[model samples]
Target: MDKINALGALGALAQESRLDVFRLLVKAGDNGLPAGEIAAHLNVRQNTMSTHLGILTRAGLIRRRREGRVIRYAADFNGMRGLIGFLMRDCCGGVPEIVRPLAEDFSNA
Candidate 1:
């Protein structure tokens, strides 16, 4: 993740609904949720949620697949890892201990 890409991903997550959408999709797992279902869960209008989904997609934070007549959205975990890795890349400098808790958290998750 370069600086611009990282900034785009972070910008996508800056909005409340977009953040909720991403987190909800993560919790929904790889199977994901249909567009309408996601909007309903967030108490957002489908059209509005669609806009958020588009921004997330462009940021590479989410992916979509056509499922019959509807589109299902899922969290792009690799993209997420890339973003985190980018942020943490320099954090390990002279301190493995600082990164230990993060590894442990992922392991627990």
Candidate 2:
């Protein structure tokens, strides 16, 4: 992603509720979760959850799809990869050891 898009995604995840929501969605995997289910799991109101999901979707961190009357949200893995790539593009002065452990974990991600 471009700098502006990356910044937007980071900013969206910076909030507590948004971060929690995003992590939950990530754990949910590609199947995703409906807005109502997400709200119930997070103990948030429907409208509030909708707003958070909307922001993430706008930032390209999440994708929304309609299934009947339900709207499900899933993390955009490509966008997530782009964000990580942007953060590690320089690799801390070309020293892989600087983030080897983190990179190892991200490999499974």
Q: State which candidate has the highest TM-score.
A: 1
Candidate 1 whole-model C-alpha lDDT, 0 to 1:
0.94
TM-score of 1: 0.93
Judged by lDDT against the true structure, how good is candidate 2? 0.90
The per-residue C-alpha lDDT of model 1 at residue 86 equals 89
TM-score of 2: 0.90
Q: Could you give candidate 2's per-residue lDDT for residues 1-109 as a string of tens digits?
A: 7789889999999999899999998899998999999999999999998899999999888998999998999888888888988888877786878778779988787
Error of 1 at 78 (Å): 0.5
Backbone clashes in model 1, listed as residue pairs:
none
Residue 68 lDDT in candidate 1: 88
Clashes of 1: 0
Error of 2 at 62 (Å): 0.7
In angstroms, the error of model 2 at 107 is 4.9
After superposing candidate 1 on the true structure, give the runs of residues whose Cα lies further than 4 Å from its correct spot.
106-109
lDDT of each: 0.94, 0.90
Per-residue lDDT tens digits of candidate 1, residues 7-77?
Answer: 99999999999999999999998999999999999999988999999999999999999978999999999
